[model samples]
Each structure stands twice: as structure tokens, then as C-alpha cells.
Target: MPTPSEFFDPSFIAILKLFLAMLLGGIIGTERAVFARQAAGTRTFGLVAMGACLFIVTGNYVDVAYLGVLSFDPLRVAAAIIMGIGFLGGGLIIFRGDSLHGVTTAAGLWIVAGIGMAVGFGLYLIAIFATFLTLLMFTGMWFVEDRFKHWFEEVKGDSR
Candidate 1:
């Protein structure tokens, strides 16, 4: 067997970690693509996740330096990313004569960013697990909401 150093170099480990983050982030994004189509689809979600991951990685690297120098906040980048993403989301939103749409797309963008942050921290299991849970919620939530709405309406009809 190789030595510990050979098996684990800091550079290799960091790179591998970053790659895994991108992979998992992409997976989370695919879930969003289902509802974000025609607005912020698969490619947009993937980009958002990767961008957030990079911002979080930078935040980790410059946190101490910025803190020590009193030059800037390391979280500034992340804050800016979040704000800019909000603007993008707003653009995606629509209110056509009181008919609302695109909120799901906007929310997906936000969630993709969170997944990226998890990946940036090299929390592979959490990131992957979160992706599964998010997907499940995205699908099951709609069904649950619809079913409840139908059931409530049926009961109300009987009462009437």
C-alpha cells in the first residue's frame, strides 16, 4: 500500500472535493429543471450551483485574510451573489393579469445555491442527501397540496 501522503495530498483532496461538489450541485439542479423549464432550466440551475460553490469556496479562503486586514468581509461575495440571484429570480417571475408563475423557478435557483454551499464545505453526504430530499419534496409537495385541496373541497361540498 502507498504511504498516507501519497494517498492524500492537500491539492488532490481539494480538487477532488471541488469536483464532487460540482457533481452533486448538478444533481440538485436537475430536480429544479423540472419546474424551471422555459425560464431557469437545467443549464441555469447548474450554473447557479457552480457559481454559489465558487463563491463559498472563496469565502472560506479569504475569510481570515479579510478579517485580519479589515479590508473586506469574506461573506461579501456570497451576499452579493444572493442579492444578484434575487434580481435574476425576480426577472423570471411573472404576473400575467393576476395569474402568477415562475416562483418555482426562482425558488429552485435559491435552493441550488444552498446545495452549492454544502458542496463548497465538502459535505458530500449532506449535499447528496439534501438533493434527494429536495427532489422528493418538489414532487411530493405538489401532490400533497393538490390532494389536500381536493379533499377539503369535497368536505366543504358535503357540508353545503
Candidate 2:
């Protein structure tokens, strides 16, 4: 068995962060798949989160200082990730007739990217809490919205 220090090694920690990001994203994706029945389900969300985390982790380890390069802003990579996610999210959205669809799924993806970024930056608590809140919004808000729609339908029926 490896020593305890091995677990705390930077490389090990980085891998751990990636797995955590994937797991968290998978949790959100599970809800979308099983409950919402979205096309972009567990694999899609997990891959997105893992990809974002990979970019962040790679940026962190680029070693520009050793290459005698100055003014390397890591946030640039983050901004690029955001822009990329925006493109992907945009693709998910569809406008048909008088209504739009996939907005929630796109938003879920956007937030999952943020969650991965957070995990990649070593903010475990924030990432986990954000994941919790995302799930809550997904499942809980769905329940609330369903109830509200039912109630509205009932009121409309009464009026008719």
C-alpha cells in the first residue's frame, strides 16, 4: 500500500479533483436523465465537467514562470472555457413556435462547467455545495413548478 503522503501528492490530488468534478457533474446529470429525460444526460454532463476541470488543471501546471514568460493569466483559460460552454449551451437551446426548449438543460450545463472549474481550483466545499444546490433546484423546483401548474390549471377550469 502507498504511504499516506502519496495521497497528498500534488499529482494524486489533481487526479482526485478531476474525479470529484466528474462525480458531481454526474449527480446533476443523473437527475436530468432519469427525471427530466434530457438528451444531454449523465455522460454528457460528466464529460463536460471533466473537460473543464482538465483545462483548468492543465493551465495551473503550465509552468510559464520556468519558461521565462511573464504575465500568464490563468483566468484567460477560464474565460475560454466559459465561452466554449456558452457555445455548447447555445446549441442546446431551441426555439419552436411560441416557446423555447432546452433552456434548463443548457443552464444546467453552464452551472456544471462552473462546478468543475470550482473543483479544479481546489474549492471542494463550494463545489459540493453548488452541486447540492443544483440538484435541489433541479428536483425541488421541478416539484414546485409542477404543483403551481396544476393549481393554475385548476383555477382556469373553475373560471371556465
Off by over 4 Å in 1: 1-14, 34-38, 63-73
Residue-wise C-alpha lDDT for candidate 1, range 1-160, written one tens digit per residue: 7743377864565566566656765665666665534556667777777777777776766765577675766467767878878888889889999799888778767777777777776766887788787777777887998899999999999998
Provide C-alpha RMSD values for all models, in order: 3.7, 3.3
Say which candidate scores most in lDDT.
2
Candidate 2 ranges beyond 4 A from true positions: 1-7, 63-68, 156-160
How displaced is residue 160 in candidate 1, in Å? 3.8
Return the clash pairs for model 2, or none: none
Which residue pairs come into collision in candidate 1? none
Model 1 TM-score?
0.75
Per-residue accuracy of model 2 over 25-135 as CA lDDT, tens digit each: 999999999999999999999988988898888888785434557556778989999999999999999999999999999999999999999988888899999999999
> 76, model 1: CA deviation in Å?
3.5
